[model samples]
Target: MSACSVFDRIFMAGLVEMNLSFASKYGAKALGR
Candidate 1:
């Protein structure tokens, strides 16, 4: 793979991970169970 594509994928993956982690944290807090 090219360097540019590799970087793009890594960046996208990081963003996805951050989003999922944020959502999961809030969901858990909302339950309060």
Candidate 2:
């Protein structure tokens, strides 16, 4: 695999993790206390 592809995957994973954390934080409030 190329280094660019590896970096892209890591970047994407980081974004996904951030999004999941964001969603969990706000979604919990939107859904309920």
Candidate 3:
């Protein structure tokens, strides 16, 4: 139970980092264009 929650939090942190990086890349590209 507790271990599953810990895994879930780590997974969500990775997901958030991915999303932020993706958005940042697209935003920079859009500005460059």
TM-score for each candidate, following the candidate numbering = 0.72, 0.83, 0.82
Candidate-wise lDDT, in order: 0.95, 0.98, 0.96
Instruction: Summarize candidate 1's per-residue lDDT along 1-33 as a digit string, tens digits.
Output: 899999999999999999999999998999984
For residue 2, model 3's alpha carbon misses the true position, in angstroms, by 0.9
Q: For candidate 1, what is the lDDT?
A: 0.95
For candidate 3, write residues 1-33 as lDDT tens digits: 699999999999999999999999999999995
In candidate 3, how many Å is residue 28 off? 0.8
Tens-digit lDDT track for model 2 on 1-33? 999999999999999999999999999999997
* lDDT of model 3 at position 28: 95
lDDT assessment of candidate 2: 0.98
Stretches of candidate 2 exceeding 4 Å from the true structure: none
The list of candidate 1 runs beyond 4 A from truth reads none
Which residue pairs come into collision in candidate 3? none
Q: After superposition, how far is residue 7 of candidate 1 from its true place, in Å?
A: 0.3
Which scores greater on lDDT, model 1 or model 2?
2
Ranking of models by TM-score? 2, 3, 1
